[model samples]
Target: MAGMKKLLIALMMAVAAPTHAEVFAKGADIGWLPQMEATGYKFYDSDGKEEDCFRILKDHGINTIRLRTWVHPSNDRASGHNSKDETVAMALRAQRWGMRVMIDFHYSDSWADPQQQRKPAAWEGHDFPQLLDDVYNYTHEVMQALKQAGVTPEWVQVGNETRTGMIYPEGHTDNWPQLAQLINRGYDAIKAVSPSSKVVLHLDRGNDNAWFRTWFDNAQKYGAKYDVIGMSYYPFWLDGRPDYSESISDLGANLNDMAARYDKEVMVVEVGGVDTEPQNTYDMLLAVQRKVADVPGGKGLGVIYWEPQGARSWSHYELSAWGADGRPTKAMEAFRVKLGDK
Candidate 1:
């Protein structure tokens, strides 16, 4: 009968639907947290009561944590920790809190960004082939370590803010073929150890479509293997390059274009605002989230604030979202406002 046919079709449709919807990640890169705690930093909730940092983050609607891992970090206060073992421990702690994890591999002993991508001291004087092996081995070793710790990261960035390239002259963008090989090695190693982890290739300047186009076109030409395209958007660091209000639309357009053009998901892997201007920072955070959430087909994976808990008093970092009073600033309140909420 027609009624029986309708019931059958409805049941079939229900069965075919996805078991769970993909969550839009609201995340923070608290890579400095352990060091901050070790150095006597305390975190408090909005109620002015002392509380665990993770609990405070959870209450602020953060569902994901991004951790950066350096090859062999120094013991310097501002630039130490985040070694492989430390990263594994942090990932375990985050897992215990039921938070999703993203591992950012700097592939260097220290920071690797547009300004510099120095080879780890251990990797110096190595040939290109040996460098490739190093990348693969190091990536595999970390992924295996995380696996052994029973913490599987949902995403892994092979390199941090690798706009020009990574690992110095060898992997620099000038040599696209070699750079592609290095990228693929890291990507392969990550997949071999954790098959489900999505590999991200991160770059700075999320608003510059032309730069993204040029960079990714070369990536495609060289066949760089990656699952996601990550970007860092910091209008504050633009140095009067352009204000956030002027560039926000470009960011949204670039996110949509990257997803469509590359056939890959995109994420705002890092964003922050001036800690002193909490209201402006709050508004900027909300605007960045909106641009990301508007990516077509839900390809906008997330927006993660970098080092939000690294209070300026302790870290001397102006972009942090924590106040000198040891409580989250109003900038963090933006995360509590869901995308579609009034």
Candidate 2:
């Protein structure tokens, strides 16, 4: 254990103080991938039964687990989404196994992303200030619930895929002030209950530097405070995965620039491309990680491969199902390489 800690510390130091040439090297050691705990479609599973999956992941190197929370889904069920109880159960299970927890707040009943930012059922008629208070109350209650369950989160995301602002219209103040207030409300709520938890402001466009500038600039304009700037990097969906070299340079520059610009840590909170695709996408993902590990800001924390085990066997709550055999998927190999475990 002492040796492992020493190695971890040494790798971090190397990443923090790499030379200019090292920053651009094709085989750089940006940092090791922090082993994470991930649960995708299983999060929405009824009865909240996923002990086997959690155990399997724990046996691996994953030390943290992330679950998403929506408001009120059109479906009147509490599987792995929208319902606070379900999320709490999942967190508790992970906690029981001594795994860290990260809760992703989507701020909508369904999927909240750059495309749409829907309002919650109760806040449909509320005004801007009222909506702000709603956000504060919702965040407080949820975090409080987790605490009562003895599952304090290691990380909390204010909004999910929020390429656009969250709690729409009023809180979505692209003008800065309103947006800052809304963002801070959530941040403050998390801090109030779980002061140790790291709060994140998430966006969808990971590769686009302009989007990062605009969103973070607006958040700052609105006095938005957060510990990390999170992004979703799905090359299959977004700019079509570039070659490993191109991905490394572009993504590394983006991470370095964003960290410097915001003076805050950054993370690829959600990232994955197709593994069973035209084949190129899967290859692209591996190359992307290699490039990131070699880039300057590639050490911007770690990357979370969104739903690699969620093979499409499950629907409605269909997350990605990258798992090929009963074992892990090819994407797992990419993460292994990221950690130098390969």
Candidate 3:
């Protein structure tokens, strides 16, 4: 009778426990960290104290680091900073700081974005079948390197901002079959290398729910097996400059819709400031936080600031909060301090 009573009591306690607690993503894309350090760029905290960038962000409650990788980048590219070895080194740093890592693979020698999904030069002559092989091999190699370096990424984006598709005209939206095959190949490689890593299908125009529905529906219909929906939200560039106040509501609704419709995780994988309006950025990000938090079952993963280390611009990203002094501007308060805090 005593053992039975104890067992029943323990079972009752377990049933009363919460199924899962929310895990909010407070993160930054410090992809430019290595290139900036090489060019004598330094980072300082608000107190004007010299500090490593990773330590500074972590102190501000950031829990994840996003890095980009490229295939045989050239000197003319955005400092050619996102090579496999470079990414491994950077991810290792994030791991040491106890931050989760998310690797964004552009898959091209240079930028692979919505507007231009240029294929890597090395893959120009290969057929579709061969290109698929290359993608699997490259992804596997990168994951292997990161694993060897003692850093396994929590998430891996097969292609960055791939609304129209990746690897150029060969795998563009116009060619859905080829694109789906390529995406799945990358997915298979991630599974083979690190089975725990979640795959993301990142695209631009995050606030526009209609676009997402169409894009994701098409992706699924064509066999794009993604574990997460990653979105890039830039106020200035999206919709020819959006009105932050009015659009934030739509952003929330869209986030909720995505979470419910996909039955998968959603994340604002990329967002940034347009002007130096720190308060506006703060307000916008706060809205994002609320929307993501409200997702049923906490499927809304988190937001990642695209190159938030705005102090140095090896890539010359205009949307940054870091000023000329290598210290973050008031704009960074969006991530550093809570909405109601000082």
Candidate 4:
């Protein structure tokens, strides 16, 4: 009977092994680090016992938390907002609760959207090489602080929505080599401090795979090395309202091709289906998740909702009175379908 049990265990192990262990057995590299600070989303213990939010996330199949960092936010005590300090607190909470984190450095005081990329106050007067050092030191300091607090991140993004370059004139890279170096400085700093942590180059416009190929290919030529490619997808914003099929298929095809082309995995870093009442965009969002899950190479690893709780008003830099109670809507429920055979 003992021998029979041993054989059974051996068979189970055999079934678990894959032909290409690097891609298959290694599992999906989807970094589901959603920006909780911006969304006004909160997690509380049952009976209102006041448990940590990260613990709640771990219970719900979430393994990562993504936090954004701003260099020097306004000293507005009235609103009680401080991106740099607040993010570190969130990181500490996640670490204590046994969750991983990914830090996104905007390198600016306020929001760094595709439209505007302002230079940080401290970096305003610095030259190009000095600016690179400043970037390195700032990133190094933040990562080191996390390390000292016993909250090393699993991943770090050099810049947020960096369709344009970072640091304006000094660190901006219209040319590939210049931009690649600026990005590389942040990457190098993270690796130097935490060797195992993965570095990501996040981009916007998830539906456009060709754009991804062109940009990333250029980065690669200049020796840009990143473990995962992070993307943001919002149909209403990117492809207008309610075009689920096109968006998902586009994401699926893009991810497969990107994984094969660059020999790296792809993740939908920021995604949210607008569930504005009377609008009811939940079902459409579910369809997007379904299509993404069916993509080839199993390249579509994870899709993080950019704050399902951002019901009516959840701005990036301001705290509004908008929020949600109980579990997420049907659109949020659709995420379970993509959890697949883990």
- By the lDDT metric, which is better: model 2 or model 4? 2
Candidate 2 residue-wise lDDT, 1-342, digit = tens: 999999999999987995532321111110011111222333222233344555545443445667778776554322334467767887787778766677888777877787788888778998778878988999999999999998878679998877767777765645467777878889999999999888988887677788889888877765788998877766556455454445545666777778888787777777655545524544655555554554354445555656554554432212242343334444444333433534
Candidate 1 residues lying further than 4 Å off, grouped into runs, are 1-21
**Full ranking by lDDT:** 1, 3, 2, 4
TM-scores for all candidates: the values are 0.94, 0.76, 0.90, 0.77
Query: Per-residue lDDT for 1-342 in model 3, tens only?
Result: 999999999999988875322457788998777877777788998889999988888877778899999989865434576889889998998989988899998998877787778888888999888999999999999999998998878899999998888997778989888999999999999989899889999988787889889888888799889899998888778665866666777777888888788788888888888536767777777777666767788788888888877553444667876766777766666665553443
Q: Look at candidate 2 and give me any clashing residue pairs.
A: 37-64, 43-80, 44-80, 176-222, 180-222, 310-320, 310-321, 311-321
Regions of candidate 2 where Cα sits further than 4 Å from its true position? 1-51, 74-80, 239-248, 277-299, 316-327, 338-342
lDDT of 4 by residue, 207-236 (tens): 788788888888889987678887877676
Q: Pick the candidate with the highest lDDT.
A: 1
> lDDT at 227 for candidate 2?
91
lDDT score for residue 99 of model 4: 56
Better of 2 and 3 by lDDT: 3
How far residue 112's Cα lies from its native spot in candidate 1, in Å, is: 0.7
Q: How far is candidate 2 from the true structure (C-alpha RMSD, Å)?
A: 8.2
